[model samples]
Target chain A: MKSPLQYRILPLGDHALCIELGEIIDASINQQCIALFHQLKELAIPFIKDIIPAYASVTVVYDVAAIRKEHPSAYGFMKEKLEAMLLRIDTDQPLSHRKIEIPVCYDLSLGIDLQEMSQEKNIAVEEIIRIHTNKTYRVFMIGFLPGFAYMGSVDESIITARRAQPRTTVAAGSVGIAGEQTGIYPLDSPGGWNIIGQTPLKLFDAKRKQPVLLEAGDEIQFVAIDINEFNNYNLG
Target chain B: MSIQVIKQGIADSIQDNGRYGCQHLGINPNGVMDPVAAAAANLLVGNDLNEAVIEMHFPASVFLFKEQSMIAICGADLLAMINDVFVPVNTPIIIEKNCVLQFKKPLSGARAYLAVKGGFELQPWLGSFSTNTKAAAGGFEGRNLKKHDELNFRTVQKYGTALKNKDCEILNWKASVKNFYPASPVIRITRGSEFDWLTEDAKKRLQSDSFIISNQSDRMGYRMKGDALIIQNENQLISTGITKGTIQLLPDGQFIILMADHQTTGGYPKIAHVISADIPALAQMNAGEKIQFKLIEQQEAEDLLFEQQQQLLQLQNAISFPLLKFKQQYAID
Candidate 1:
C-alpha cells in the first residue's frame, strides 16, 4: 500500500480553502487530490458551494454566512470539520476512471503548429501524431475558460513550450499542447498553446445537465480522423 | 411590460448573482462587478437580492420604457434622466409608459446597475442569468445589449397598476450610497498562498507603491501598472482554482486582479486577494485610477465582510420599515 499523503490546508480568503497535496505534479499526488475531492464531495458538507480538484491541490468553496449560521465562527468551523474529514480520506482507494474518446483531425491545415513543432523537435509530423494518439491522458483540471479541460503528460519527445506570442483568437474545439500538457479550448478565446489538431465535439454546452465534457480524474484518448471524417462528423 | 434599447452604450449586459457551483466546470462567475450596488438596487425596487439587473459601463445605455414600471439605478452616478428630468439613484422611481430614459456622461464610478421591479425576463444558464459572452450563452441571447434589443419585465404589470401615475414618480426615501465609496484609494488585501514566493523588495513594494489601473482592464481582470514585483525564486505554479479579487503576479512582474468574470482557475502565482468588503470599492475604480494595498489579517478581513453584510441587512430593514408602515396605514396589498 502507498504511504499516506500529507497536505497543507490554506485559506484562499474568507470564503474558500485550498488543500495543497504537493508542490509537484505527479500522477500519484493528483490521484490523492482526486480522492480527497471525492471524499469531501461524498460527505455532502453543508454550505459547500464547489470543490475544484487541480493538478496538486483541491479548492473547497463554501458559503461563509451559511457556515456561520451553523457554527459561531465560519473559518473555525470549516477548519475543524475539514481537518476531521482529511483523516478519513482513503488515499489508496482506486479511483473509478471515466474513459472518453476524442476524435481529432490532425490534417496539416487543421494542425496549425504541427510543422513548427516538427522542425523544433526534429521529429516527423506523422510521428508526432502517432505518439500523441497512442497515450491515454488524464484530466488534471478543467479551467482557464468554461469547460476547458487541462489534460496531460504528453510524450516528452513531443513536448513543446507555449507560443511566444499568443494568438488573438483560438477557435473553439482547437486541440493544443503546452509544455507537458494538452487541452482543448471549449470556447473561442485568445490562447498561447501550440495548436496540434481540432475536435468537432462541443466540449461545453450550457444547456446540458453536465456542461463540461471532461471532469477531473477522467481518462481521455485521442482518435485520429481524416479531414473528410472531421468535416462529416455530426456536431449534435 | 417591455423596454426597448434605444442606444446601447459601451458594453451593457444583463447579470445576476452569477452562476454558482459551476467553477469546477471552468465557468467564471460572470455577474455584476459591484455586488453590493446590485443587491442594493434590487432591494430598493423591492426585488430579491439576486434578481437580474442591467450592468452598464460609462456613457450608459438609453432605454425607452414601453410600459409603466419601477426601476432602481445603483452603483455609478451616470446622471440618469427620464424625459429630460434628473432621476435620483439608490431610490425607487416609477416611470410612465413611453418615457425615454437616458444616462449621460458618468459623474462618478465606472459601472451602473439598473434593476427593475420583478427583475428581467431572461432564462438562467447554468443556474444564473449572467451573460458569459465568451461562451456565447445566457442573457439577452448571450451578447451585450444592442440598439433596438427589447427586454420584457417579469412583474411590471403588477407594479404598473399598483403605482400608476401620469408622470414619473420618485420614492420618498433612498438608501445611503456613501458607504459604498472608498474613503481612500488604499484597498485591504490578505496575503495569498504564494505571498512568500516574492522577493522582500517585491513584498515591500506591494505595500508602498501605488499602482494605476491600466486601460486593458475589464470585467475579467484589472491589470495594474506599477513597480515590477520580482519573485526571489523561479517557480512554476501549478494551475489552481482562483476566485474574484485574486491578485495574481504575472510573469512580467506586474499584477492583475481577477474580477467578476475572471477565469475559474489560473497558473500565475497569486500574491494576494482583495478583501470581500472592499471589492465594491475596487469595482468602482475606473481606468488610470491609482490604488494602494494595505495588508490585513484574516480575522480582520472576516470582520470587515461581516460588518458589510450587517450594514446591508440594516439598510434592508430600514427600507422595509417605512414600506411596512405605509402598507398597514393604506391597507394595500
Candidate 2:
C-alpha cells in the first residue's frame, strides 16, 4: 500500500526494507525484482547501501544516518523513493539475460557421489551426465556463501535428495544436487548437497572484475569435459 | 618489529568496521562483534575507527610485545594483566617491550578488542581488514591468531616514552562506556515487517518471554531457546535481505537473531529487530545469558542510534586532547 506499484515494502530492521514483488517464486516476479534492482542501481541513491534481488523480492539496505538528515523518518523517506522508482521502472522491458556455458568433468574421483547416484538411479554415469548437460537451469539467487548461486528446477527424473550427513568440507567448484535444486559451491565450506560433478570454471574469484561468474536470472547449461581439459582450464 | 603470540585463544581473529556493499554477491560483512566497544578502543589508542584490531574471545591470547606501543583493551572485560599489573579495560596503557599481556579471567563480556596506537600492519581484503574465515581470505592469513604468530604494528616507531622505565603505565583519561553495556541488559527492539504474521497472543508472548542464548551460536547468528511462536498463517516466505539484528522465527518456533556474519538473505518470518543501538550489548552477551526484548517505536530506535553515535563522537573528542598532551610530554610525536 505504501507504493501503488503492486509491491509490498516490508520493514527489515531499522536500516533496510524488503520490497516484495510477489509471494510465490515465479519467473516474472523475479524478473521485475531484478529489473527494479538494475533500475535502482542506475538511480544510484546515495543513501542506498545495497540492492539485493532475491527470488521475488528486492531488499534495499539503506543508510539510516544519511537518510534521516533528508527526512524525518528514514523508512518513510526510502519507501516513498522506492515507490516513485517502482512506478517508472519497466519490469516487462526486455531484460538482458546471459546464457553461460559451464564445463564439468563428471569423474568419480571429483564427483564422490556419482557412482552411488548412478547405481541408485539405475542409469549409467554417462547417461546421468547427459541428462545433466542437456538442460539449462535458471539461477534463482546467489546466497548461502559468497558467489554460491542457487539454481532451480532440476530434471524430475534425476532429482536427488541432499545427503543425510553433510560433508564437513565441500571443495569449491563442486557441482551438487539438492532435490529440485542444483548449485555449485563457490568456496570450500561445509555442504549437504549430493555431489555429481566438478566444474573447471571458478564460480567465484574475488580478484576478478566480476567476482561471481553467474548472477540471478542467468541461464546456465553444463558441458561435459574430460579430466585433461578440466586440468588444462585457464592455462592460457 | 612484531608482537609474539605466546598463548592462543579460541578464535582471536583480526576485525575492523567490516566490509559493506558486497552482500549482493553473498559475501557477509563479518567484522567486530561490538562496534561501540571497538570504536572506543580505537579512539583511546588514537587510531582510526577502521583500523584493524584483534578480536579476542574469553581465555584470550597472551601477546609478548616486541615493540613499545600504546594500546587499549575494550569490550568484554577480560582481566587484562601485564607484568602482574592489572591493565584496566577502556583505558589506554603504555607497555614496554618484552612485557607479556594476558587476559586472566572473563570478568564480563564475550569478546575483547585490543587496539594499538597506529593499528595492526595488515592488508585489507575486498576493501576491509575483517577476516572472512569462511572464504579463507583477509586478516593474518585469513584465519584466527595462533601461538607464536607475530603481528606487526603499522606505525613502527618509538612509543611509551612517558612510561619512562615502567613495564606498563595506565594513562590518565579513560572511557565511560559502562552505561551503554549493562549487566542483563533489556535489549530494545522495533516491530519487523512480518510482525503481524504472528497471532495476537503470540505478539503479547514475545514481550513477556525471556530467551536464553543457546550454545549453538556464533558471529553469524544467535539461536534463542524460548517459547515457540506459532504463525497465524502458514505462508511461505520468499528469501530476502536480512540485517545484523533481524529476529527471525524458525520452523520449530524458536528465534534466531542474525548477526555480523549473517547471510545476505533469509526466508524465515522476521518477528522483530533488535534496534541498532542495542546490538553492541547483544554482541557482548554469551551462552546461558538471559535476553529480554522491549518493543519500542521505530522513530525511538533511530533516536537511540543517533544518541549513541553522538556519545561515541563525544568520547573521541574528549580523548584527543589528552592523547595530544601525552604525545607532547613524552616527545613521541
Model 2 alpha-carbon miss at residue B303, Å: 1.5
Docking quality tier of model 1: medium
TM-score of each candidate structure, all chains considered together: 0.96, 0.94
On residues B1-333, what C-alpha lDDT tens digit does candidate 2 reach at each position? 678899989989999878887887898888898999999999998888768899999888899999888899999999999989988999999899999999989998899999998888887888889988887777888889999899998888586457868998899989999778756658989998789999998898888888899999999999999888888977877778888999999989999999888988888988999998899999999999988889999888887786787788899999999989988887877
Candidate 2 stretches with Cα past 4 Å from truth are A1-5, A113-127, A207-209, A231-236
- What would the DockQ be for model 2? 0.73
Q: Model 1, A121-149: lDDT tens per residue?
A: 89999999999999999998888888888
- DockQ of every model listed? 0.73, 0.73
Candidate 1: tens digits of C-alpha lDDT, residues B1-333: 899999988899999978887888888778899989998998887788889999999777899999887789999899999997899888988888899999877898888999998888888887889999987888889899999999999863434444545458787768897876668999999999899999998899999899999999999999999979999878878888888888999989998998989988888998999988888999999999999999998778877777777788788888887657644654545
Q: What lDDT would each prediction earn against the true structure?
A: 0.87, 0.87
Chain B superposition TM-score per model:
0.95, 0.97
**Candidate 1 deviant stretches above 4 angstroms:** A1-3, A70-72, B158-166, B325-332
